[model samples]
Target: MLKFFVVTGIGLALLNGWIIWWLWRALEHTGWLRPMLCLVVAVLGVSFPLLYKLGGDSAIEVWLLRAGSFWLGMLFYVFMLVLIMDIWGLASRLWAEPPVAPRWGGALLVMGLPLVIGCASWFNAANPIVREYDLTISTNDPVPQTYAQSPLILGVLADMHLGRIITAPRLVRAMDLLAPYKPDAVLYIGDIIDDHILVDVEGMAAALARVEPRLGHWVVPGNHEYISGSIKDSLDILRHSGMQVLRDQWRILDNAFVLVGRDDMSRHAFEGTPRKSLPEILADIPHAHRNLPIFVMDHQPSMLDEARTAGAVLELSGHTHFGQLWPFHWVVESMYENPMGLLIKNGLHSVVSPGVGTWGPPMRNTSRAEVLIVKVHFTQTAQ
Candidate 1:
């Protein structure tokens, strides 16, 4: 953990230094103006991390966190824009006539573009839309008559990093959007709360318990839960919110299907406690219930093959946030098999949500914040 922080700090310093150097050269301003501009950039670059370390639940802290987070988002765009400008300038010098790029205009383009897009992205992140998917799985064994008659309408809420930035109102709004679907059960695929220190546990709990699904709410801890530095507290608050935390555990729902929740892979790294393997967890199912279709809720989508190999029919996950921001999605996509959206490998159905809340910066450009509604149908295979 210390190593991670040290590496991150170093990276931030170098990146900020590069940005400052570019701004200094590009601005071509005198005295205080250039220095002030660089100072502002450097401060904004480190603000979020610095404020995060000096943890407090005060209003001032919360506002600073928000401002710092927004700046972080803007900073990404600024960095990219500046890099592009540098490349363009180099290419112009090498081949074409050096295009007369105005200093102020260049400055405006770097700052203005991110500002315009960041504001729009903020609005986009705030308002989450409901996306629906229909899935049919074939079962060799006969499904219960009730299950066949009524498809399972599972509502998925993932990555609601409810802390300083994502307050109760955002959670309330997300729940309100899911109300119409009337999910049989709501599955929180982790990162439900960002940090226990900054989170309003009672308020978030109250808002979460507002709508009661027929089968109730089930949750698995994402990396953020462990990252929050109070995993127990986060779990307690989630339980208070009427959510059942399944840490490498399984529950038979209505005696119709198996619901397995795996602890996030980060558990081993963060807590030094490794969760049960998919097959190990599945082995705990009673012989009578073995044939039942297995549905899984894993915070990270890293274990799809394990779930599939363990005979799970459907696996729901969130943690990717679909890269959350633009171009970063490309990076995220490179890491995971199915970074975002749905993927079916052999018989396993995996739905990875982009999530309903922002992690940092509270802005999204590549993907929209979404609540997934999966209507799962069970069809019996021929004898």
Candidate 2:
């Protein structure tokens, strides 16, 4: 906990420092611009976090705080772009006189670009595009010929981050998109609730109750479930809503495949529950089921080798929203071998979804919001 606090302190300090420096360059004029820049810096860098923590739980107050955070994040990116252009203009003037434009033209350009881009991003996030993948998890081991009799269509939705941005209407849209597939089972990889905001637990449960499949509706907790020490509370709510909450447990589906759900890595850090090792979880599954094709639901892209070693043929995961924004996906790419797609390594297949809801900005700049409609076949290859 001490380490966490120290790291958080350092990060906030650095972020505030950068905001101050950026404001200084972007608004150098002394008259009214000085106060305006100071206000912007205060609101964008410091006030949002502080207010978010202290704000009341009333719907009005929550919306105010959320809106402040969203627009500030959007404007921050705009400020960076505009500041870069300004620096380039100044550098060019050192070598040759630059073409003159109206004083207000620069201001409009700086403000207009972010406004246009921000609106588009908001629309894109509000309307998520369906992304589908057809994969075959093949194995050389002796398998049931009955598995080839039919394909298992599994629908996966992850990282809903519900509370502020992901409301019932948005969730309904995702359900509507996945309905056509008529999946036999739906596995929800967690973050179903937003940690920082006050959520209507009953309302969320009611909305989720609408999503029913023929076989089962399963869910695994993500890092957000442990947020604010609400893991157990959250689990109870969802369980009451007809979801089979699987925490380090496995369930057989149609006698053809075994579904294993792992507790999020944060269980120890946040919930004080020690997570079971992959081998321990695998030991419980009958040997006959092992060869029948194992599909594991791990929330994050960790413990790949352990799952593979345990004979898991497929793993479904989320938590890297493919960076959930532009240029940031580059950073996410460096972190995970398969950030957002189907990856097969040594016969272990992993599919990581980009997630269905927004996290911070409520805007997906380049990253798409999607649910995975995966067709799992026990065949020789991806064909």
Candidate 3:
């Protein structure tokens, strides 16, 4: 259905271009510089699809998609209004004369220059993501350390669609910013690489190694981990960089804390179904371990009800890049019951980030790529 509209639109635009070429020659006798004017506009109008496709993999693509969707329609309406004014001026010219070349030329340049410049600015920006989050615990749980002290923090920067565009500089800059907080544990949420982590496996690994957290670094595989080559390769890259690859297992710290790492929700089975339900995941927590504080690492944050019911402390997730565009941002918000923020239900807390990297286009449109620094306080009261 989508391809149908795409093809039809492009085809008609091409047809329109051909007609404009013929019209340009015809308009020469009417004092219209049709060859110089309408020819350029018509060519641009016809090849808009090509421009859209080219922009899809770059930073400007994000902004262009928005302007193409919303502002483009607005421009069309404005163009129609201007055409009416031009008609009236032509009628007036039959009686008197007005300056033709300077007024209209200046007006067109003024209107068009800013749109082009706006796109150019975004295109030249070195990095699209600007990471920001306020890390604070729910002031309800009395888990010992409150906001009064610098809490032993755990951070997860996930779903970085770090491809050809988001290079080591962006990743390095992220580490430099995060290092100031001095986290105890840092986790790469998933999708360390876009299609193939191996494409820049060595470089990404070096960057991950530079991420100096005091206690440890952990990584849970995302769906993108399995794309292209073997999943083992992606896991190996993460592991080589001093990260523990927790796959479908729980790590217990003494008797007080447990971090359960589940397989990517998109990858339903590794060996067997084993009940393949939220209840099953809850059941996976050993009976003796149930009372301990729990944190969950899952790819997409599915099965929210079970996580809450089981008294999971916090569940961190990425994958929804927070619409990444204007109109699409509305759709992304509607897709989630809680949207993109902190949601705690039945004493279970969840934080879904806009993510630090992009997937479809290399650039971000509406939501800037972010590195989440969530501070979970174990407080006695809301202070």
Off by over 4 Å in 2: 1-41, 44-47, 89-104, 139-149, 379-383
Q: What lDDT does each candidate get?
A: 0.87, 0.74, 0.59
- Tell me the tens digit of each residue's lDDT in model 1 across 106-146: 88788899999999999999999999999998876787786
lDDT of model 3 at position 348: 74
Error of 2 at 59 (Å): 3.3
Point out the higher-scoring one by TM-score: 1 or 2: 1
Best by lDDT: 1
> Which tens-of-lDDT digit does each residue in 301-334 have in candidate 3?
6667767776677788777767654446788777
Measured by TM-score, the strongest candidate is 1
lDDT of 2 by residue, 29-125 (tens): 5578756755665565544455555645677666666666566546556557655765676777787887332244455566577778777887777
lDDT of 3 at 313: 74
Superior by lDDT: candidate 1 or candidate 3: 1
User: What's model 3's overall lDDT?
Assistant: 0.59
TM-score of each: 0.93, 0.85, 0.64
